[model samples]
Target: MESVKLFGTWFSPYSRRVEMALKLKGVEYEYIEEDLKNKSPDLLKYNPVHKKVPLLIHNGKPISESLLILEYIDETWPGPAILPSDPYERSMARFWAKFLDEKCPPAMTRACMRTGEEQEKAYEEAIEVLTFLENELIGKKFFGGDTIGLVDITANLIAHWHRFFEEFSEIMQPPLITKEKFPNICEWVNDYTNCSFVQENLPEKDKLAQLYKARIQAAKAATQ
Candidate 1:
């Protein structure tokens, strides 16, 4: 097997998603922590276009972007596939994963950063996105049915980071996804987080919260 290396920050969901995929596949890899504030030359050299963390370097070849890296890992390693085997199921998984990739980040990022009317608008937008996911998850234990798959992986932010948003953000209305309101999604969160690999790989919540709090303060300062 070729050498695998991941450049990522501890607190990033994108990085965690890749880490989980590699763990699920039982692939051994080197983990390199990158500071987003002062990015290293390797990160810039490997992913000059995006200049982002979670870049997977395989056999000295670098792959950037979390979703794309996940696909690469799934293809390269192949055991306990993160994506389904059936072509149609794989297509559906890809669709929803891409949808969430486009939709979830902006809505939730805003919800995390702003505290006033702007935060309300972001919460509304996030609700719409989560509601769509909630309905899709109806009658299903996981987004990929019985087992966690691509869509489930893509929705990792909701399962883990969202609660922190509720705790940190001032404009809390609906309250971070509850079983009463989004039963399937709530159930999915439990199932996903309880998975042994995910449990083992997750970062400490207190540290993550503190990191995010500083980020939110910085974002607020930039606006003022």
Candidate 2:
């Protein structure tokens, strides 16, 4: 029997994406939850450079980074496809995923967490970045068209996690993400979160909200 183990955290969208992929592939894996404050020894051993969660260990070989882990899962497992088969479509999916990871999160975080001029700049930047995704979703139910695919999974941070910051932080004035501004993204969030597999893998929203609230409080405390 092949040995599969995953080191991840409950609240991390990165970790959840991997779990969603594994479950989608019907690949049973031993899940080891890691405390981000004090990570496990095996996690350090496997992902020495980053020393982060969402590390995948398969038959003694280790893989770091969530997107890479998702690709690995798609290639190694025999199940419903996580990435599109066609080379062009697959490349496009990877492109969008990379764009999301590289461009969206930092701007969105700064928009919510920073103040005054910095926050305004980040908010505008976030709107600009999100416009691309909003346009991409036009006339499509999912980024993957019908079924959830790599882009959809990678978007979990935007679809789900970002909401908590808006909900829990008072500093997020004027709001970076809104239904009026990005209707297509709103619909996509609805569709993505409503999916059964996604629902099963997501952390409880209330709990996540509290975590964000505490983190926001800590950030404010530090700034003062």
Candidate 3:
């Protein structure tokens, strides 16, 4: 077996996505924590295009982009599949993942940087995205249906970050997503968090809250 190594930052949800997938599939690999602001030469060389963490290096080959690396990991390791087996279902899963990577961070960024009109607009947009997710869970336990697959992992990590955004973006008026408001997703979060691998790995929520609060304040100060 070739050696597998992962470069990631603890706070990034993008990094967490790959972490969850690897654990779920029971892949053994070494993790290299990177200081993204002061990126290492190795990370820069491996992911020169993005210069981002969550780069997966298998044997002598390097794969960048979280979703692409995830698909590669799934392809390489054929146990406990992350994507759907059916072609149509797989397309839907990819669609949701793409939507998430494209849309989510900006919503959080907009909410953090401005207030009044801008902040409200950001909140509205964020809720629309969250609403799509909440409604998608009407009958299905997970995003790609009953089994926890790619889409579920992609979106739930955002919902996790929303916990931080709530405090960081005090102006945020998030739509119904709590245990009382959206019971299925609430239970889904609990289920995912309770899974031994997720429980053992992933960032601690309390620390995330503090980091987000400070980071939001920094963004606010920078823009002002």
What TM-score number comes out for model 2? Answer: 0.97
Q: How high is the lDDT of residue 3 in model 2?
A: 99
Q: Which tens-of-lDDT digit does each residue in 4-68 have in candidate 1?
A: 99999988888999999999899999999998989999999999999998999999999999989
Score residue 203 of candidate 1 by CA lDDT: 78
Taking all chains together, each candidate's TM-score versus the true structure is 0.92, 0.97, 0.91
Reference-based lDDT, residue 17, model 2 = 97
lDDT of 2 by residue, 94-187 (tens): 9999999999889899888888999888888999999999999999999999889999999999989998887777887777677999899999
lDDT of 1 at 146: 87
Candidate 3: which pairs clash?
A: none
Ranking by lDDT: 2, 1, 3
RMSD of each: 1.7, 0.9, 2.0
- Candidates in order have lDDT scores of 0.86, 0.93, 0.78
Please state the error at residue 212 of candidate 3 in Å.
1.2
Superposed by TM-score, candidate 3 places the C-alpha of residue 52 at a distance from the truth, in angstroms, of 1.2
